[model samples]
Target chain A: MSELISGSEILMQSLLKEGVDTIFGYPGGAITPVFDALYDFQDRFNYILTRHEQGATHAAQGYARVSGKPGICLVTSGPGATNAITGIGDAMMDSTPLIVIAGQVQAELLGTDAFQEIDLVGITQPISKWAYQIRRPEDITWAVARAFYIASTGRPGPVVLDFAKNAQIGKAEFYYKKCEFTRGYIPYPEISTKQIESAAQLINDAKKPLALVGQGVILGNAENELKSFLEKADIPAASTLLGLSAMPTNFRLNKGFLGMHGNVGPNMKTNECDVLIAIGMRFDDRVTGNLKTYAKQAKIIHLDIDPSELNKNVKVDAKVLGDAKVSLKLLTDAIQNAKHGEWIDSFKEHEEKEFEKVIKKEVFPENGPIKMGEVINLISEASNNEAILVTDVGQNQIMAARYFKYSKTRSIVTSGGLGTMGFGIPAAIGAKVAAPDRKVCLFVGDGGFQMTMQELGTILQEQIGVKIIILNNNYLGMVRQWQELFFRKRYSSSVMINPNFGAIADAYKIKNQEVKDRKDLKKAIDEMFSDDKPYMLIVETEKEGMVYPMTPAGDTVTHILLGDE
Target chain B: MENENMTLYTVSVFSENRVGLLNQISIIFTRRRLNIETLSVSPSALKGIHKFTITTFSDADTIEKVVKQIDKRVDIIKAFYNTDEDLVYQEIALYKIATDQLIKLGSIEEMIRTYNIRILEMNETCVVLEKTGHYEETQALFSELSQKVNVLQFIRSGRVAINKSKIERLSDMLANLNSRKPEGYVEDDEYAGY
Candidate 1:
């Protein structure tokens, strides 16, 4: 028989068995026992005590996105568990694997309105992939194993393990059996050969074909497979926001980004393609402007691991269900090698038109207040296109996503699905922790920067090397942009009286700088990337700058506005 | 609610007998604002597995998504939706009437005879009647009795459904689930049959 161990030890052991060495969390009433256990095993784990529970969950999400491992976090019950809800929802939408262990009132006191008592499971059920409560010591091993298994499987998402006070202190014989199977759970669905063949046939028969890729390619570790399929079929590929880093920016068949604020070429060409192959991407409303007018001319083919995502948005002519790597390889093998040089060249005219109107001006502006794009472009060059670009929501996210180039896979980490603000500081810290050797740069707006600026303390304490570039526009830029076009520029609650970010960084004992001129942008970025210690560079950006080449909400993808007009 | 796309659909979900599973399933319907017309839970033919049969009104798209979401649960084995025409179904209704008052309504026994209702118990004060049929048939019997005599209490069971594809498909699926044992896996002894 295995040696008797406390439930807290068993929990620690189970996490270790799953190859987890780091945990981001905060302590409170119900989870004190587990924290006490950590006192002894401190050398074995890098437990990060984040300033807030929400920051911990977002940090774990960023870790998960970068490492392809299920990020683990712990917090005490009641408000602690509730605080993690937004991050859990973000992880759910992003398909980022996270295992959140929240403390609970004792098994006996549960539902009695006891101190720190909350229905963590009930609250997390919708947002989490699975929420299981461990009420006894014996359940710890299996529950931990199950939580990791479910959180990291097919479409990765957050799993909450509600550890009760009794469970934390209860003693039981430790068994290290890994949960590889559950009776009713099917993590991976078999790839249907018939679906593959029909999809290949559609690809082969198409006159002009385009494929839009999403984060599933990176999640499936199918970047090479996608490249092969795109090359073999000679298809021009566009990327969803989450799919930014799946292919290198300089790849031959790479067309551009897709969505509301995406490039002009892909948005316009979406209507021109005869066959639209949606690979590893759900047709989010952002990508499909007006469903009625979006891709009506094309025969839609969707490929995803989740069956529900097949026809969830737009009806598809074909459904390829399986791991993307497997399906893409099958497709690459099934379809005859061919090239659509003339068809591929059709997007170039639209690209040059956008370049002259938007890209050239945004990134290469000669003067005026500092533009957001120039900062990102300078960072990309300064870091040699090797930095993992993380961003807070709004203009900075799209600006960095557009201007920053990626040379590494799994390099773009952001809250894509939920679009949560205050996600940047902690997420970038977690990213740096996950990839210590890789440079990590964050592009955040002034409004979002202060939302979770408390995590600057986490960086200083952990000494995490995350280069934070705050694009201070003195307004909630994305909302203001929308207000400018859609809301008649009323600017309700969009403007902000900013904080002294440099002083905040100084208080946190981290290196800091601020630049207002365009010429100083390159030098500031270079300085931020020079060393392996955390640095924050605040750049005062264009107060009223707008992200152009936008397909107005519910407007057809083909019809886009290049300028504010 | 009056949209032409709306139609009655029976969503049958098979899952392990698990705590909070019902609430999770209910949330799926509630979130969509689709009211559950009827819901029944019972042990399935397979040991350790329970089946929940729910009937609701939804458009084709919403129902399809709802069933898929139900099937996505970790403890859930499978979920399917069928129109009334696709399933052989029935609901059983029970009626309790005051015996003395019931007899005063002329031709009540004759009406019961025509409907093939079985009298479960009778006393000086009351009588209980049971009828099994489609929803409308059972409702018709209840309405007839309520109109003529006082129904002390009336109750109706949720619809029980079986796919017309035959029992072989069900057995085949059960067998298939049993065969799909992942590595280092064993069914708990509580689920003895599997």
Candidate 2:
């Protein structure tokens, strides 16, 4: 017997096939049919209703970013779909896997000036990795499958599917299947064997070769292979901002991050290394400093999944285009295992010396709330290396990078390229939903948390236990940090008026705490982790507290300035 | 200059309207800049779309780069550059000559025949003379005619030229992106099981 289904069923079926267990969304006129269809199959999936469409999109982004799975979200037509623009753009810039299904006015009303009708396909074309408008019921499954394929594969990004009202209602046979996209989409780059040979040779011959892993390693689930590769090659490794947690921070060869505010060992190693094998990193201008002098002593070997990245900026002595896991595994297998115990020991020696010289001196103002570093270190210690740390942009991100010794693969998820404010809480909510067994904590600043604080309602409604620790500096600390350093302390528009965050959490019916002193911070953190309810901790900090060892924008690795130096 | 030496010319062309107008005219210029030279609605071209024919005034390699940048702009229909010696070209203009100097010009009839100029419009106070030929020839006439008659209200409608040689346009980039099929191209089955 054959069964007939509506286009909405096809959309739902495609999400199920893609292993999308949760979706964050809002309901509206154009999307009523999707909601109705979702109502029937509610057991098959979970939909979290958000206060706004933007929250739904950000939440989806957060889930995708942390889980390395395709995040799914639904929204109504016109304004609801348009509201997801910023979040979708953020996901695009950061290369997060997201499948955004937006309802549209009926096929007949698509171009007409009908109520709630808009050209969603045209509007989302540039921002999304791919977008499709389904006018017929029969094409719904194919379009949605195509959306997932485009979104999850290659360089992951947001893909929007505009389901027309009539099409969602019209009947069609549902057949969920994987599809081959044979059009203006060539996602993977072909890595030449010669290129692989040269890259492997560089790894085999280097005296101090460091593997700078990025988010791509984690996204591809290649962390285990990378760890094995590092162990086999006996090469020390560092990470980029997005690359944190790809290798466990406590690993013997892990040298932490290697950019402007990266760890002392990694930053120093980048300056001294003879060969740097940058795997899955863009060598972003921020990471490379001045491109001309970036790694002048080294022969760079760049291995990335994207072709455009190869030789686009930093000249790579060898460019390999393949999956980081697959590529690293191959490179590991080809080379004979060798020992570089002395080189590894040298890294530890430098780390210890720098730790004594710079990190040992911690002079706080001797007042109010704890320093951001103290909050981060205390929380990192309390969480016991199992918590997923999601940070909003600014000083909070920098402090988290400095203090958190991320020991799990893909444990830290932040909006790296987009650096969107308020990305922390919703992302934390999504991350908690993705991995409920693992404790997810949000390290957000007072300025960044306010952007999407409304998602606290969703957290409450879902009763998902997430610890949101807000560093109440009363300013957009990163901008204020920059303004203080480079802009000569003009302090414009960075300051925030007193916000009753504890009261706001109470209003949402979530448990709230205020940590007023350094000792109180540790107490608040302990209580937050032990609590079964959604909790927010307001840690009051110095108004202009800056994260130190800051390399001014576009400065080299050696051009770092420690605070009060 | 050596026989092999060359430079590219970035030309701005303005012309009259017709269908397949650009393809017909630009077929003459080889190694053309790929975008029209900022087409604007000229008071000429009978108040039609002002088309630009942008090309580099250097060697073929320089013109290739110039063409690539210009071809990307959506507004431009066509772009190409050609050497002055290679193409049949023409520039046309209308000059309203003062009637008082008509006698000093010895007769509009004699001058029109001598310079291959056409008398498009005539009035009692002024005579409008039209010329169509190579851009240099038209300029020469415009200069020589001004000597005899006070060239009142002169308008150079601009040049429309093309290369006499045949050349194929550059290949499309979108086509290149579509034709690639690396390993693991097909993740799904050729056909789903029944």
Pairs that clash in candidate 1: none
Q: Per-residue alpha-carbon lDDT of model 2 for A1-565, expressed as tens digits?
A: 3688888877788778878789899999999998998998889898899888888888888788777788888999989999888788888877788888888999878678789887776676556766677778877776777777778887788888888899899988887766655333455556577888998888788888878888789877889988898899888998888888888878888887777777667776777888898888888876767776778898899888866566666777987888887888878877768788887788777677556554554323345446887787778889897788888888888788767878687688788877788788888888888888888888999988889888989988999888888989888888888888888999899878967998899899989899877766667788898865688888887777767666777877777676757
Q: Native contacts recovered by candidate 2, as a share? A: 0.07
The prediction achieving the highest lDDT against the true structure is 1
Clashes of each: 0, 16
- DockQ metric, candidate 2: 0.08
For candidate 2, the TM-score is: 0.77
Docking class of 2: incorrect
Best by DockQ: 1
Candidate 2 deviant stretches above 4 angstroms: A1-4, A111-113, A181-184, A348-350, A361-369, B1-194
Task: Tell me the tens digit of each residue's lDDT in model 2 across B45-97.
Answer: 32333456443335665454444323322123334456666666565677788
